[model samples]
Target chain A: MNAPTSIKEFFESGYRQFLPHVSIDCAIFGFHDNQLKVLLLKMKNVEGWCLPGGFIQWAEPANEAAQRILQERTGISQVFLQQYYTFGEPERNKEPNLKDLIDSLNIEPAEDNWLFRRTISIGYYALVEFSKVTPTVDLLSDECCWWDMHELPKLLFDHDLMIGQALQTLRMQLNFHPVGYNLLPEKFTMPELQKLYETILDRPLDRRNFQKKMLSLRILERMDERKSVGPHKSPYYYRFDKNKYDQALQAGILLGF
Target chain B: MNAPTSIKEFFESGYRQFLPHVSIDCAIFGFHDNQLKVLLLKMKNVEGWCLPGGFIQWAEPANEAAQRILQERTGISQVFLQQYYTFGEPERNKEPNLKDLIDSLNIEPAEDNWLFRRTISIGYYALVEFSKVTPTVDLLSDECCWWDMHELPKLLFDHDLMIGQALQTLRMQLNFHPVGYNLLPEKFTMPELQKLYETILDRPLDRRNFQKKMLSLRILERMDERKSVGPHKSPYYYRFDKNKYDQALQAGILLGF
Candidate 1:
């Protein structure tokens, strides 16, 4: 479906059903091929992109609304999603391209339409394995895909600010929580996990020291299986021991930044 | 001054100006006498108490609303404030004692009163020195004072939940930020700072190890002068080096839990 159809349906069917002046946006970060990616929705007719977001139903909780949006767009479930921040600056609705976004959709919004009002958006983010999700476009966008974090297109409204805050929160969360395990495959080499951490942190870490610090936390269990990549020496596959990882998280796993 | 007058004025003069469906609550933490305390307001003519909070204006940013609420209640300014979480559960406004709270004020709310709506509150917290603030009662309460963290009165609505989340955030923030400096008086003994941390973390730490860790951060300057207590050996007074503290904060000072 394209912009005109989506806008037509929104005015006829979905506009009034949304909770006024409040929405939820999810910054679903995915990891694959040693690169960090974020799930974004490409606006059908407009040359813009935004995080997969949806309005809160008046009867539903904000968190439940976020979960529903993520499930509807990406088909990922049972992941721990955290609410990082609320973006409610009044000027956010006055984005320069907002008129273009509306015009491209080929619909004139009524004065009473909730889209014209300022919105208070709650941001929720999670780290997920890229292979787990089958991205599907919802009524609001034509295409949904994972884009590299560094090469993101300019987003609608204050979504760029939302992504920046999510990344900062994830970096701080990395120091106290073992988050890399879920973003990687079930059995992955040490280099893969280290590379994931380095990407999220946006810094280079000493290989030997990183391994030593990670091992001392006692959360990762080295598997007997080994993976041979090309002509390089084989590396043992390691997985997180769930119980120990939880315990370490509660005890404050301080990673060297 | 009291609930009757506050409520009378709220109905007579202040009921319609609040931004519908959104508010800001501050868990203003204060440190004194080596104990952590939170600023709470006692509900006049009712048995419940709650944190200092206020509603956002329609044209105001949430952060500005929080700062206004904090300043209006505590008479303090220019302190570091952090927005930690937004509580948007639908059932939060369905508390059983809400009627009692309204009834205690002896004013009948209009059918369209904003107070009857479900509000999503953004929680912001800051650590401040107790002596700096001269707490004042707002139009909704009779008394304002610092309540010990270990012993808190039953709070109204989901304020208790907000305070709990704020404390958890503060504990995590303390791990990487030099927050003790603002909460303590200038030129304090090492033990005083340690006690403040212990109180906030709700756990004890080794005296020598805590001192070593704090000193190594290089944000505190040891003074030649010392204070004597009767026959006890004088403990050296130390003050925070503001420039060094900012540098260490920028560099991410990691304190052990």
Candidate 2:
């Protein structure tokens, strides 16, 4: 099946090429300047923002669909993407009047169109480097950009709940999965690593305890290089030992604060 | 919408009452006699075992659908159910001859019936008390029973893979989520608790170390009672403090092995 050429085609015949009532939404997270951010899209003619989402192609694996959707929007692929949850409330995609919303976009379909059916969305959260994303909008979206995690605008549909669940899963994952592999620079200071954790966890950690806990994981390799601030206050740079980090992830070792 | 009353009705017009191409399968795990077990069902005319699964009702949430399915199969409800993964490989449900499988069971449908479409299954795993369950078969199943985790027979419809992923997720969850709350009796000896972990982790742990780590988490309360084994081997019983266990789960604290 070929890709739909227009929004009208997507509304009318997308079920021919894609699985109906099943979609993938990504909560792309990036870390920069001691802040956490999420990728959001402003839908065309819709007032509120939503996570980048798309239906699964008939022949594509759902995980691949997620990666494809992310790449289409962010021009980034192969980043650390984890399927955290599936949002499937009967009214998750329900609008006050979906017909009115579709009418505003100038697409009309039968009352029983596949798009109007209840959708069960698989939620995936990606950890991507902040600087590498080139945000691109889909046909339905007018703008694609990152918003501060703490200051997101009102989201459409159940997206606000989706983001909250994704963030909660990400925080839970921090207990076992190594962080900063995709979100942090290759060589970063200890404080930078701690800040990333603090931002995701939304709380402060005792600096010494955080550093001690991280080093105890044995996945981080201290580099001889240092980020110099003052002569006496330079923090040594560190990089994740990719092999060890991968091993720890596979082993599911707990790296608690 | 009412559920299909017969298998033929299910194959014919089930799509009207249920979400098409999306279903929920539960990997119901129970612990007994220091062994971990999973609930499996035998289809009416099929030989292979399978996890308990059912389609989501058009009016129901996926989570509720899972609970309903589990309750229908095991006569157990309100257990510790977790949505761990969604299996959407496009071919995850493809059979060598789905028509033949249905034919053997004496059902017939059109070539492009909704049942023939590719399905994306949401996988949820539940922890249920072994003694509390009274396995029951659905309209399409003949027998339902518990099988040892290590000694499971051949499974149907990618269920073998589903169980593997569910177990992996459950093992990883041990880092943050309290286990044995649903699988164990209200009071269990320390050795019994250790056995549960060892069985799930598929490895042996130092008994002293395991007890020390579990005790340090502060969620377990030592009961005044003891399980008398021998004059020299009476181990005290322990029960999870429901409040602290729930709090720890909410806080997502790392309870590393």
Candidate 3:
């Protein structure tokens, strides 16, 4: 099926090309300046912000649909994306007066249009390099950008709940999965690595204990100290040992932090 | 919408009362005789077994629908069920010459029947007490029973993949979640508990190390020794400390296996 060319076509016949009641939403997370942020979008006629989401096409797998939607909005491909949950409360997409809202936008859909029907969304969460992302708006959205995890706006629909659950899943995954591959630079200091963990976990960690635990995981390789500063001021830089990191990820190592 | 009365009505007008492209499948795991088992169903005229699954009603929440389906098949309610993944490949549900197969059933559905359309199924895995369950068949299935995890039959559709992913998720959850609250009897020995863990992990663990780790978690409490066995052969009984287990679940403790 071909893509709809206009809003009228999208509302009238989108069900022909896309699965009617199933959609996909992505919680794209990035680490910048020691702050964890999530990407959000403002729809063309909607009131508040929400995650970058789109409908699944008729012949597409759900995972491929999620990847396509992420690439369309962020201009990034091959991201670290994982499906975390499916939100299917009956009234999750219900607005207070949806018909009146659609009328105000000058679109007249049939009483039984697919757009007004209940939808079940598959939720995916992604980790990407912050500096490399170029957030772009889709046809239905007017603006797209990042929002601090701690200072998020009142999101539309059940998006706030989606973000919360996604964050919780990501935090739980840190215990087994080797993170920072997509969120950090090629070379980073030990303190920088600890800060990333501390930020996502939303807690403080002892310096010595954190270093000992991380080093014992055997996923990091320490580089030689920079000679630019004095001996006492110079701190060692470290990068992830990619081979060991992948092996640990496959074997499911436990990081007891 | 009211439930359909017969197979004819279900094929003709079930879409009026149910969501068209969304369904739920459950991988119900039970422990019996030191073996991990999953519940499977054989459809009335189908060739192979599949997970116990059903459609979602128009107004029902997905989670409530899963609980209802589980109760219908197992005669057990309030089982520990969790949503793990959503399967939505375009051909995941496709069967070769399905039209001819439907004709053999002596029921004629329209060319655009909802049942023939692409469906996205929400995958939920449940943990239930094995002894209390009474497996029962549904309208579409001929039999329902427990199949040993290692000896499963060639399943229908993508169900084999679903079971594999669900088991992986369950194994990963063991690192943080306190299991055995529903799988074990009230009083059990250390060997019994260790056996449960070993069965799920698919590997034998060092008995001393397993005991030490479980004890350190502080979610188990020792009980008085049973008087039936000889004094030297007697092993003290133990049960989950409910309060501690719940607390650890909330705090997300790391069990480094």
Count of backbone clashes, every candidate in sequence:
0, 0, 0
lDDT of 3 by residue, A144-255 (tens): 9999999998798899999999999998888877788878888888888999999999999999998998898899999985423565776788999999988887887777
Flag clash pairs in model 3: none
TM-score of each: 0.91, 0.94, 0.95
Alpha carbon lDDT of each predicted model:
0.82, 0.87, 0.87
- In model 2, the Cα lDDT at residue A231 comes to 68
Residue A176 alpha-carbon offset, candidate 2, angstroms:
1.6
After superposition, the stretches of candidate 3 with alpha carbons farther than 4 Å from their true spots are A96-101, A225-231, B96-101, B227-231
Candidate 1: residue B151 lDDT (0-100) = 90
How do all the candidates rank in terms of TM-score, highest first?
A: 3, 2, 1
The DockQ of predicted model 2 stands at: 0.88
Cα lDDT for residue B207, candidate 3: 92
